[model samples]
Target chain A: MTRILAVGRYSDVDAAALAAMGAQALPSAAALAALPAALRAEVHGVAFMGHESFGAAEMDLLPALRVIANFGVGYDNIDVGAATARKVLVTNTPEVLSDDVADLAVGMLIAQSRGFEAGIASVRSGDWQRRGPLPLARRVTGRRVGILGLGRIGREIADRLAGFRCQIHYCARTPRQTPGWTRHGDPLSLARAVDDLVVAVVGGEETRGLVSAEVIAALGPDGVLVNIARGSVVDEPALIAALEQGRLRGAALDVFWNEPAVDPRLAALPNLLPLPHVGSATVESRAAMGELQRRNLSAVLAGQAAVTPINAP
Target chain B: MTRILAVGRYSDVDAAALAAMGAQALPSAAALAALPAALRAEVHGVAFMGHESFGAAEMDLLPALRVIANFGVGYDNIDVGAATARKVLVTNTPEVLSDDVADLAVGMLIAQSRGFEAGIASVRSGDWQRRGPLPLARRVTGRRVGILGLGRIGREIADRLAGFRCQIHYCARTPRQTPGWTRHGDPLSLARAVDDLVVAVVGGEETRGLVSAEVIAALGPDGVLVNIARGSVVDEPALIAALEQGRLRGAALDVFWNEPAVDPRLAALPNLLPLPHVGSATVESRAAMGELQRRNLSAVLAGQAAVTPINAP
Candidate 1:
């Protein structure tokens, strides 16, 4: 009987699939602390959000653990290096959630730029004069659009906006090439050239605080800012100040400075369109993500090389 | 001195353009009432919202009205046939507000599919446990997108969704063979084939109440509906019923069945993403629209052909 652990809360476990394979479920203490020990002790592998890494401190509990299947495309939460050091394989779901997350980024962009909520309030307030018409704001067409970190998501955003006929520019570490996109070596360089700067960079040690004051200031007053990346990449204080002083025209952010708990000052901002980090938070996409995790875990149990191996790096 | 009749309440008029052209600006009511006197004196043209058709009834007011420059795009507001009969040139601003409006449509699509406002409320209510994680509800990709009314805006939307790799199908009066899109002859046929229906059709008599009960029923319980087009295109009561009983998956509408007074029931719906009509609402876009309007008005006053002639139709 193969033991399985679930580190994160998923909508539904495909019970039929596991049962068909004759696998015994062992949910994690963190995930299933309320369950009886008999139910918890039978786990062989753990499934987590974003293929999360268990530190060496927590690795002792899962002596039989062989694989961890993550629920999202981005696997930064799982310390690949640490997992690799312990000979633990990690698998993640990707590509399937690309369009979903990109859709969120663009949706947040429009909501922020156009004041969708404010427009609703104007009519809901029941002031006849306020219900005139939808204001024709300056368009994104033909505007210079800069991508802060041109990875999978960033490239997808570019492809999405291609029909809007925007001039695309991106900043990446290696200065690589992609079709129909201008490359920048640094964030500030990309900022200086575009009317809108979208931060789609990763989070963690190297990228933390990467979108500093200087890069933001370079974007200037007549620009728009968007962040669908993790909360750590941006200098939150700089962004909030720029918004408050009207130095930045508007901002759309899904990820915040802190997870779950956002700064009240940021929340109070009328110029900001704040969202609970919902990049890939769509039912079909999430279910696909979960199923992908299951497949990866099942493959590991079958002694096959796990697809999307995070520890390979 | 040349007089220009300005229609519509614009918050920011292009004072410099009017001043530079040496045209006297008269507010809408004032111009309408005093137009007869101004015609005999020395009025040059009418600067109005996209379309403000001067009927034969108002023909007496502006014998000298050589031009009618539309303030925005979509010239249906103006009686172009009447203007053409009077030999008054009509113009509309084109290619300016396309991207912004397209952005609005896509925003509505994402917001509805992802349950954006509900997700936000879940966080704001301090009921974070109820919310899903990085993977969200019904995604944007891979949906069979059926666009009702495939004009410029619809084309723009198709282009934007190209990256998502969605199967695109559209309905129009005459079959259009545009690149990268599959055209369906009728709305019912289009709705029958897709999980998502986006109303990007134009407004007015021809298109009013276009999305009928049959079409909604065809979309079924798992289908998502998005309306950034005129509200009159959809059947309100039918939509509400479909939503209430879960006959349709969800809906996102920028335009309401009625202006200012949305169906109170619709506003209270959990399966709806309701917004005030915010199509083309963006600062830069609005400014550009104003600029175009001013230019058109100036062109008419100068006795030149307006760039976009609504009266041509």
Candidate 2:
């Protein structure tokens, strides 16, 4: 019989469903290390939920673990190198949440560009009639938009934006086969080419601090930055400074370097539209992610190939 | 020489441009009525702005006025019947602002569904990490969306929503030739068919209170109402009552009946997402509208056909 270790804060419903799938619900990755060897030795798979660091040390505790299935498209929290080296397969839920994330990215861009906060405040503060008219917001449609990464989620954002008549520019290692979209050589160039930039790059060592100070500077005073990707990809201090000085127009961020604990300065800025790590937080996406995670766990436990494998065994 | 009257609050730049086009700039419609008979009688075209009523009385004052080129898509402020009865041509700036209006509508829907306010507050109040997790937001993708009037803006919204995998349904005077969209005969049937209803009907007497209490009741507790059209189209008191009683999920409104002076009750509702009447309040859209209005004014004053005519001469 296969035993699975489920980690992270799962809702009662999710926990119950995992229990039905025969997963032993462990609240945290730290809890797995504290488990009795007898119990840990029987665990063959992990149904992961939260952003807890899982490295070689944690992997060593689960000697019988054959697979780790992540509940999100971004699995940066899980050390794929360690899992691959240990011959453990890693799978992630992708495509399932792409629409939700892309939808948020487009929505945030429009909200920020359209000055939704001012609009809301106008109504809430009862200053709308007194103020006469709110300031005109920059247009979202027919403007130039740059996509940081032209991956699955990025492509979705770009495709949605194309309908708005935006001229699309993107930066990737190599230009893709997309027609009518301009390709830039680097992040700075990409930022310079468009009025708005949406970061959709993957997270990790190769892409860490990819959107640097130079890139932010190139984005200029009237440019808006929207980050639906990881926080590590952006220079937090530089971003805050630029926004404070009014060098950049605005930002709509879903991720942060120390999320949940986002920098107070970033939060205080009226121009910053901050969201919890909710790029894929919709009910439909969450259920699909859970289903995909379960399918991946069940497949590996059943000695079959994982559906959305992130690393080779 | 054809003398043109540029009415309403114009930006200094727009006023200057219209003056350079040989149009007399007036701050208000009342100013036009106050003009000397000699100056008023010479006015052959009016570049109108704002929502001051232009009825038979105003038309009687402008006996020489050949065309009223409205600076917005919605000309509910202009009595088309009176214009038509007097053999005066009425043209509106359409298509130019349609994309901007449609973009805002979709953005507001996504923002409300994703709980953008909570997300913004989570970061602003520095309670994101402390709060642990924000409540799951309803998904925008894959939901059924109903457009109250599938005109130009409605079609644009429906097209953009299709990319999100939403099922499109609509209510119009007659079923449009749009394939794959579910058409209903009345507003009540349209509300019943979709989870979200976006009011895109034209503003005026024929369509006033089109989305009545019966329609709202059909939309139910899990339903959201988005109004990007005129505020007069929706029953504001009924909407506010439903929101207060929790009979409806939420509403995102960019227009109000007495706008600028929005009902404080509607503004105070946590479930309501209020925007200053900014459906087409974007720089690009505003500039395009101004240009279109100028073109229409120039054409009619030059004894040429008016473009985008609302009422045939």
Candidate 3:
């Protein structure tokens, strides 16, 4: 009997890992809904991946669902409130992927500041020899940098930036004990205080559009924005306008409102460095995430608590 | 009287700064040689830039040249031995640009490891929509990283990587007081011990081809090579062969054997991230370098000591 349904796209390694645990694979939440009623009734937990929504309607399909083990740090797609209401535990793999996410965030910041895209293009097209030195890029070291959120991933990014000698400023509802780091009450104040702002906030209705137009403008014409958080956290149109009007210097984005199919305007900007949402996308991190997800599934299926539960349910 | 002749390329800001110091600008060493004997005789110092050879022949042309104020950290092109023999002091802008060089070095490491080139390409070409997530990149954080030469720039790179939780190992002729960092006696030992090797040795005859084929081989198929020091420090042909044969995973190069005109073979390799010698190429660092170069020029022209002399003559 299939005790677990591994939903969403899974790598071959992840699929094999799931199969070993008596779990059957489904391509997505839609696929899980299409499963025969008998099989759906047998599934006690879900090892979920991807950014597809899994709300109350999907929960009703699996009467025996005890837990949803999310394969990523962000659980915005899982509708935690609905899971809580239905008495189905929602667990997410965090901390394990923080290093990978922070690494990309810092990498993107440096890449944009140093104009890596133009530099690579010049070398590939033989333009370096033809045109001599590229226009000098801005220095990244010792600059003032702001973090939009001071969560697990945000703290990691700040810690890494400290090595670069950056003056770290962050915005959070309540200040934490981060010595040598300046704390701000709001995003606008934080953005105003720094030359670069990296979005590391959570993704959900409460935090949606947290990096609004005012925050972007406060960052000013010399400021750079790096978003490693959810796409909805930043106002895409405002960001687009800021770049288009030279109200902002540049941006490096790994996520977008419509990812995989990013807006053409954002993609066409010469000053923007666009990356396909690759945060937490590394062989090592993925393996760890899968292991954590499976552990959550195993614990919950055995009538115990989920390993990294989001709610008591 | 033109007390200082600013040789090689100069940005407008640098040229103006040079002019303020009662200096005249020449396009290159060739241009300096083309100057009339009377004009060359009046030049007390040469504020030099670029990678052109400046040996005894060029030194002989400027009979009254008291010092060469190089506008970059690397003074390899100045032929310091010849300067010493001729009783002409050689000064280079060093510490002022270390941060920028280190920044680019670390940036390139992360960029190459994360496959920034391919990620940017996929987004620009709209292949991200056509395709799904990119193949997982190797984790950069907490990896064993080796610095080939523990110089000022190399030390800076190691310091930054420490924040990423990297286990730092370095190769230096004589060990310094760097606690917690593993020091190796030779490049081969360093390569054998680490997953990544960053070349940060000085350039010139003594250090030419320091990262030879043997060293590249020891780094192995999973190893990455990052060269930010000088083109002469690494064996270009060996690097190309290693990448071509899959003997090494990848490389990120800021300097090349014949820069501006980088070898097409290296450029063609999918595994290599080739930059056009942009180690210290930033607006802030260049400005700082120019100021330091001028300070060296001014002091030398005034019959005092060169501020940052490579050789006292």
Candidate 4:
């Protein structure tokens, strides 16, 4: 019997791993719902990936679902409240991808400040030869940097920035022991205190629109914003307005409100260094995520505790 | 009488600075040579910028030229040997731009590994909406990184890479107090020992073609090459061929052989991330470099020691 259902687009390595575990593959959640009710009853576990909403409605469809193992660290798409209500264990692969995410966050920050988008374009368009150097970009080293949330991934970003001689300031709900880093009371204070703000908080309702208009204003016109966190954390409309009006210096984003479908206005901004949500989308990281996800699924389905459970349901 | 001549393209800030010092601005080295011998003999110092050759012939024209204050760290363009022989002091702005150069070096390394060129293109071309996430990029953190020179700039690059958790290896002619960093005897061994090689050696006759074909071959297909040092340091023809045949993974270059006119073949490579020699081109760094250059000129013309002299006469 096919006890596990692997959903969303996966790498060949991940697909092979799933196949070896006798897991049935589905393109998406909608596809899984289209299956006959009798067929859905046999799925005891799910190894999920992607940004599609996996809510109570989807959870109810899999009556025998014992666990949902998310492929990546951020599990905002998976409603943990719904999973808990349904008595389904929720697990996420974390720590494994912190380095890759942090690496990209730092990369985006430097790319935006250094005018890499324009620099790369100038070189490729043969403008460097004809037009000379791009306008002088801002210096990255020794700048004041603020992390929105100093979680595992945020700390990693801060740690990397520290090497560049950047002054690290952060805000977190429950403060961790961060020596040599200044901790702020809230997002607004954090934004006001730094030259650049990097959003590294969690996703979901609590954090939705956490980086509000006030926060953006506090960051000021000379401040750059880097969002490797969920798009929901930032008020996208305010960000767009600020960027359009030059009220913000620039932005380097890896995620968006409607990702894979970014706003054309945001996409057209000359100062932006936009990337597809590729924070943890590295060959090594994805493989580790897949392995962790499989382990969680296998453990939960065998009547043992999930390896990295988010909810003890 | 104007005792100083400022050459090459300078920022508005630098131009203002030179003007305040009663320095006459000429366009290039050729322009300086073309000046009337009477006027040229009035110039005691040259605040030089750009990549033009300043050899014995040019030195002979300015009988009163006591100091050549190069406006950047590398004085390769200025013939230091010629200056030494002529009893003309050669001073360069060394430490001022190390952070900027190191920042760009690290940025290029991450951008190349994380496919920032393709990723940026995907976002701009609306390919994310049309297609999907780009193929997973290689992870940057924890990779083995080799520095070809452990000079001030090389040390800065290694220090930044250290925060990324990279295993740092380096090859330096004179070993410094590098505690955790593994040292190699030469470039070939350094390239062979690491997954990525960054060329940070000085540029001139001795160090030209330091990253030779054999060195590139040793780095192999999975290794990346990042050159922020100089165009002359790497063998361009060999590098172009290796990139063409997939003998190396990729290269991120700031300087190129015969730059401002890069080889069309090298520029067209999908795996290459090319820049217009912007290692120390940040506004802050450039201002600092210009100020340093002026100080050197001012001191030397005032019958004092050059502030940061490369060749004392």
Write one digit per residue (lDDT tens) for candidate 2, span B46-74: 89999888889998898888899999999
lDDT of candidate 3 over A17-57, digit per residue (tens): 99999888889898766789998998888999989899989
lDDT tens digits, residues A100-189, model 1?
777777777666666666665555455423446655444666778898888888888877766667789999987666775888888888
TM-score per candidate for chain A alone: 0.88, 0.98, 0.98, 0.98
Regions of candidate 1 where Cα sits further than 4 Å from its true position: A13-43, A50-53, A127-138, B19-31, B34-44, B50-54, B123-126, B129-136, B260-263
Clash numbers, per candidate = 27, 2, 0, 0
DockQ for candidate 2: 0.77
Tens-digit lDDT string for candidate 4 (A110-210): 88899887887788789998988889999999999999999999999999999999999999988689777899989998988999999999999999999
State in Å the error of residue A265, model 2. Answer: 2.0
Q: Which runs of model 2 end up more than 4 angstroms from their true locations?
A: A1-3, A32-38, A174-180, B1-5, B21-26, B30-45, B61-64
What's the true lDDT of residue A27 in model 2?
85
Off by over 4 Å in 3: none
For all candidates in order, the CA lDDT equals 0.73, 0.90, 0.90, 0.92
CAPRI docking class of candidate 4: high
Model 3, position B70: C-alpha lDDT score: 91
C-alpha DockQ of every model:
0.52, 0.77, 0.86, 0.86
What is the per-residue lDDT of model 1 for residues B1-313, given as tens digits with 9 covering 90 to 100?
A: 6776565555555655655565455655335665457454466676665223456555447776777776666665466677778787778777787777777787778777876776555445444434445344777877789888878888888777766778899998888876667778888999998889999887777887789989999999989899987778899899999999999989888877666577778777878877766676667666777788777777666666666666652
Each prediction's TM-score versus the true structure: 0.88, 0.93, 0.98, 0.99
Model 2 error, position A124 (Å): 1.6
Candidate 3's residue-wise lDDT over B139-252, tens digit each?
899989999889899999999999999999999999977858999998999999999999998899988998999999999999999999899999999999999999999999
